[model samples]
Target: MSRPQHFGWFLARGFGPHGWGHPYLDWNYRWTEPALYQESVRTLEQAGFDLLIIEDAPSLGSPATIDLRVRQAFGGPKHDPLLLAPYLFAATQHLGIVPTVNPAAYLPYTAARQFATLQHLSGHRLGLNVVTDTGSARHFGTAPPPDHDGAYDRAEEWLAGIKALWNSWPEGALIADPARGRYADGTLLGHVQHRGDYYGFDGPLNALPFTDGEPVIVSPGGSGRGLGFAGANSGVQLALAPLDRESISAYRAKIHAAAVEAGRAPDDIKILFAIQPVIVSSAEEADRVVAASRDPDDAAIAYIAEKQSSDLETDLTALDLDAPLDLSVFGGHVSQGSIARLVGKHDVTTTPLSTLLAAHARLGRISDRTGFVGTAGEFADLIEELGDWGNDGVLIWGDLHPVTVHRILDELVPILRRRGILRSDYVTGGLRANLQAF
Candidate 1:
């Protein structure tokens, strides 16, 4: 049997909503209302996308300072994605709304009740993207951000505790028997006592259980331990699609084995990779887009430094990007799992700081490096090949401009349908059901 591929629209940077006061959007919704996201959500459902993951971060850059952060509006000037989930749910019949949340930042009970409420209200269309990061933890004076592996450890306990709270309300706990003058089976439920290494959560979660099962859990695994954690817990695991088929095959096998080791069936988890397909009418246009022109100078260097500071959770602006960096200052401070990825294991110690910055500057141009640049049909073929390589689905990141969105909806979606890769219509059940269908 052929399992069709799933697609999700990753709505980060407020795709169309934070229009920067631009009048050309052709969208009538004000920034404060659901009107902006409703159209995008509607378009996604029409094109048979599976879910919409609303990416969020508490800080756009280093939380310690304000000038560069506010100046560039890096990821600032944002409206909460959680604020939009309800509106999105009201606007569409399908498509899961999974918002990113760091478990450590919120009291486990609050997170549990919030998602459970959303699941019930959205008809089980809610999913939660669990993220373990340090930037946001600073704001609330929570425990210091754990090192990469340590963060995952906290996450394991955090998720377990949250699930326990969700499970506090047993199945059929609400009796609603008017004849007996009873509203619920008091003995059957209320409150959970979960004591874990990282958290002590006591419930009866104030919210009732979702009508469907617990809201879907999503984890993005960027490192080895992260993958292991995702394998053990996530219903859907996200990966940025690799540049080659070998890496794709290797990633799938690794994550699949991790799931099996965690006592789950190899097929139990759906692995979706992030892909941004640059659709164009012809090959020449693709070339022009790919041949991006940029000159890296002092200003570019400063921006890169700020970005690094933000990512590494430290300050790098004072250091010289054109010279070798001292390994001692940041030696143990850097999170092994994430930093190793940023700069290679060997280069972290040996390479000059300038070279590292240059590499990342080039990497930021990856959009020019990957994806098919031809007509929509050609891009569809590329998608099939990518799916054949391994991922169960792709998380598409594209501009929300009318031309780009329309080309995808009009030109690309049809080809995907004709090839039998995209679903013709949404399944009758909720987001999890449709996701697991393939």
Candidate 2:
């Protein structure tokens, strides 16, 4: 297999709690402007993004404090990611849709059938982001004695079963005959019976593997169990978010090393980092726009603090805006502790009050992290730096959807094409074929 250079876009718009913090009903109104999804997919297709990673959660929950607003916001029926991919694939020829699915809640047969059907319909424009049940166990109401590691043990069996099911049908199984009115040959359809630690499944996956081998496999698991899962199964792409150069390099090396251990080529996996690029026509204009996207009020900041670590109501309201933010108040670092590590790595010590206050305005910036907040050329320069700093590419994010998408497509993409870092037109084929892998 020829290893193609990898790059992809992430779509967490409807289900992820990562953006804007809008209520569920109001989410589509604010985060996604009218027709933005179609436009964004087109932009990605035109820009030669390898695939669009679509994230989905069966349910949303915080491990620590239950943020009632957050829960209420996500409590409604969500857009089924697997169900949505066909429509998205129909709309675009080259862009692949990788939807995240939890292995715990659904059966392997059902999951396999749905994905196979999707691959058949889209001509194989699909990828899988396998999220083990660890991160959302409590949220799913399946109280776990099995830690993430245990869940992953179960996940291995699930993956194996899924693969067996996908391969159940032999090649040339479909022979539509008019004389006898036969649609398929029974000899081609084989049974896959599996009885494992976590699950017992039997039969041929009730669908055809597209003319291609299968949809691409992608995952974002960095934990030991997640790593093993990715190494054993993930082939085309891997997703991650690292705040600094050292972490980015380390993560890339880790992925390459994992591939080697898995008996796969080291460069087989592509790395795409998650970033919300706030680009505008000018540097000052970009900064102004980014600042505007931040909440000037305390409620949102407090909510972020609660989600990230411990409660910080007392210390958050008492610091100078210009001073370095201190991490002393939460006793240590809280949830998303990497934010703390990034701060300490850059020597950005400040009162919790100051950090919270600044978070409401500066967004995820500490003293040193960089975001694309400038003219098209400047954004391109930063993107190149990220690539040189050892990332395969950057996955652009928006503070607000359509606005961000419009600016990126109009501004940044053209500059990238001129610089030869991004393609001017999509390669012809399904998602995997466009990415140039078997």
Candidate 3:
């Protein structure tokens, strides 16, 4: 039997309307109340998912208009995950709540205190997904945005400062000895006298020291700089790549080697691929659903093109959808995140117009690309086959809809458990221990 695999929910909007319209309107999900998000987290806990990543960005995505972003709901206007995380942690005993934090957007002292307080309160069931916001120059309220490698350079310093602040409260600092009237050992307090290239800070975080450890650190490492950052800091690395076994295996090997270079054990960091699973009642249903999603028609292409423009930073709305494109127009200007991924498949420098538009439509419209489309039995078989790479686990894009989410908990997970690839129940520990258990 294969080892038990781990799972996480990769949510862009807290609880989303991933498709254009409200498919889960019957589920009574109003963005105003915490009830909907709470219910989703509870469902994940029931299915024994290791963590839930609250994916966020400071600004909304492209077409350079609010109408498009709002219409699509593609990574826009999310309730602050940090604010929502505490409520989730309170509700679930085992599920890890990881909120995306942009280091540049926050002061180190402020972030250190924020996460430490949550970690202490949640019994260390907290994890933080760190992102380097490369969308625009003004994301950090700076004159010009940091370039690709520059963003990571700042992240390195930012995280170092945060760790220093977290370390300020030394081990065993909370000595509540009533008999001796000693509240804490001041002598053991750690300090953060950090002055670096990107940020500077002094003094220690005052929050109660995290007794167990800092919350799990999560990072999406698809770029070279990102891989280095994840290797050095991320407890769990988020990966998105071409859906091929060989590519996935080579990617894991690179990350593992990065960790070794950083003076850490290869297994210390787990890589969880961003996957969208299509689990239906039977193989036939799966085929139809997948075909529609992968080979989207004109309407689907236009719908997705708006979102892709945001990622690629190239507006395709005015261009010919069915006609071939002039790729040279985007010679030097290209998007970095999801846009880069779609463009990678086509020859952006020389490809025709329609081909570029099609590629954009396919990736932009569809979120999860870890292609396992079938019933639970087939899904489990696919997972076991991929596990041969020794990649840690897969984070479900989950489609941000209740029906899809329910299928994962109800149908997909059961088969995984029966096949011995999913945990029947959680073992004892916080986020890190629970994650490393697999």
Candidate with top lDDT is 3
Q: If both were scored by TM-score, which would come out higher, candidate 1 or candidate 2?
A: 1
Candidate 2: clashing residue pairs, number? 5
Scored against the true structure, residue 395 in model 1 reaches a CA lDDT of: 80
**Model 3, range 392-411, lDDT digits (tens) per residue?**
78888854455657876687
- Residue 170 of model 2 has an lDDT of 77
Ranking of all predicted structures according to lDDT, beginning with the best and ending with the worst: 3, 1, 2
Candidate 1 residue-wise lDDT, 1-438, digit = tens: 234798887665552245543454555445566666677778888888898887777655454544544444444655667767898899888888888778766788888887787888898999888887765556767566677788789888888888888877787887778898987776887657777777786778777766657778888867788889988988788776455788888888888899999999877788887766656777666666545423456666667777666546556677766566675555343455546555643456567786666555432222244444556766676678777776688787653444446766688888888788899887766888888787
- Residues 1-438 of candidate 2 have per-residue lDDT tens digits of 112235576765543332345333343543222244565677677767778777665643343433432443432224566766666777788777888777876789988888788887877788988776454456546654366567678777887888889888777777667897888887878778888877788898777656765778887777666766777777654555555678777877777877788898765666677766655566567667667756556655545444333222123334454566655644221223344432533456444444544453454322234444566676666667676675566666442254455666676666676666775465545666666542
lDDT of each: 0.71, 0.62, 0.74
Global lDDT of model 3: 0.74
| Candidate 1 residue pairs in backbone clash | 191-203, 191-204, 192-203, 192-204
Candidate 2 clashes between residue pairs 3 or more apart in a chain or in different chains: 324-350, 325-350, 325-351, 326-350, 326-351
Candidate 2 — which residues are off by over 4 angstroms? 1-6, 15-36, 62-77, 135-145, 172-185, 236-238, 241-245, 286-300, 306-372
